[model samples]
Target: MNERRKLLLHEKVEVRQLEEGLGGSWHPGIVIGVSESCRKVRYDELLCDTGKSKLIESIPVTGAIEGLYQRPFVKSNYRGRIRPRPPSPEHFDVKTSLSFGVCVDVLFKEAWWEGVIFDYNEGGDERCVFFPDEGDERKFKLTDIRATLEWDEFSGHWRERGVWTLVSLAKEHKKEGHIFQLVKRIWSRLKVHYGFMKMISEWTCGAYCLW
Candidate 1:
């Protein structure tokens, strides 16, 4: 993989959007043009709120690059289609038994991130959760934490802490399917613009090489 591969015009890439406490999220865009002797790129990013494309120009080349996957950073809404159903309150109560060192998934940037509870004040509503992968810790409400779960494809249910929860895994699977379909549509458009072989090469190499 080469980090020095020159970014060309009309390429699909993602721009990094940094957050205050949370590390960051990548938003997808298409290279529309280049400037400053090709040190910067002009691109169009989809507006999650308006359902329209917005043109952003002169983004540094280092800021915009290919992503691990060709999908938008959807917030709240799933592919701008529907909001994912939160874990049913009737099924499990996270707050009553919340404690330190308990494994849970916290909803952040519209996705479930695995983290372990590090501290919690009894009778308080928030708990400190540590995300080891990011080497970061943050506070979250009980409503945002769900029991750490693994999908059991064979039995078609979610396993909480290695035990069966009996909740259908269909919604999670459906969300994943929606993302795959959206990526396929974007890939088709890129192929038409860049041709199959070139698109494959650029995509496989990826913008992550720069970092």
Candidate 2:
């Protein structure tokens, strides 16, 4: 048997975004993956709200590299005004909206345990117990999470450019309900994009690299 190879901290992280969505409809925004060492990457989906309608906006994935070993997380704030629709004499229903945002320090960690052993007794025999060590485990943590909205523009697609600053972990709180809601919405969108069967096929073989 070959010994398991340990991966470098940075080598264990991955980030990717959903390829579909009209900027604001909750597409895959950011995905971060980590390995046992704590190396991580964040992939964010950026949306620009052009003056045009929300349906015609383009959202793109932006890449950011973060290393916790370098420094502590910082906080950032962003503000902007957006016209949900193009200005027109007939478009009296259009409204101007102001967006305020903040981004704070986010942290991630991962760990794994391999080849753990267990012991057991057979036939009521006190000495008949043995265990083998074999398995792997992983974990991830995000802290000081925040984001700020800067300026929003609408051309053919929606675009929002902003400055992201890390914040203090003291202000962070876990919102499992909100997280679950967002995840549910994203999964709904994914199901619509790819039907049940196709989604299963792609998830098992294509997107997740299960095959």
Candidate 3:
């Protein structure tokens, strides 16, 4: 099996004004790595995460080298305390869920293993020949991917919502078994359902709805 080599490049990031009351001022830092799915950019020169940090800051990625290995996708972590409910207590309180969305442009390369082609002989003896899998050869093109983040204060949790888009040349040519559009639709439904459930549970205090 042949392994593909990943490329790396060094880059710098500068943060301007982020938002009011969000904490922290504009700062500069370094971007160490880029993966097929995520970008790892860190900054400590300005101590933005410090308790005293306030105000919003935007980090600009420019003049960055091309073909850097991106970071892997990881689930966002949420930590909060949930208020306990008293059994046989007073009236219930209505809760509302908070959510935000952001759009991003990502470029990554992914490879899949396709099946091999076999050749057989007409005689009693069978000969098998394997051809390089064409299904695995592809460059996924994604644009204007929208990602959302939702926080359930009542449940003390946060979740992500969105269906990422990917364009596959092999799928367009009908050489691959799966269609990119179909896959994206299915994924979208799943994300939407999960997000809705999270909101409903928080609002109704774990009430189940039919339909």
Who wins the TM-score comparison? 1
In model 1, which residue pairs have backbone atoms overlapping below 3 Å?
none
Q: What does the lDDT read for residue 139 in candidate 3?
A: 22
Ranking by lDDT: 1, 3, 2
Give a tens-digit lDDT track for model 3, residues 75-123.
2332111111111112322231111111111112111111111221213
* Model 2 global lDDT (CA atoms, 0 to 1): 0.22
Model 2 C-alpha lDDT per residue in residues 33-132, reported as the tens digit of each score: 3333332233233324663331222222111122122322321211111112222224333222211112111222221111101111212212211101
Ten contiguous residues with the weakest lDDT in model 1:
75-84
RMSD of 2: 24.4
Q: Estimate each model's TM-score.
A: 0.36, 0.15, 0.19
Which residues of candidate 2, in runs, are more than 4 Å off?
Answer: 1-144, 148-150, 153-191, 194-211
Error of 1 at 64 (Å): 36
Residue 70 displacement (Å), model 3 = 20
**Clashes, model 3:** 14
lDDT (CA) for every model shown?
Answer: 0.44, 0.22, 0.27
Backbone clashes, candidate 1: 0
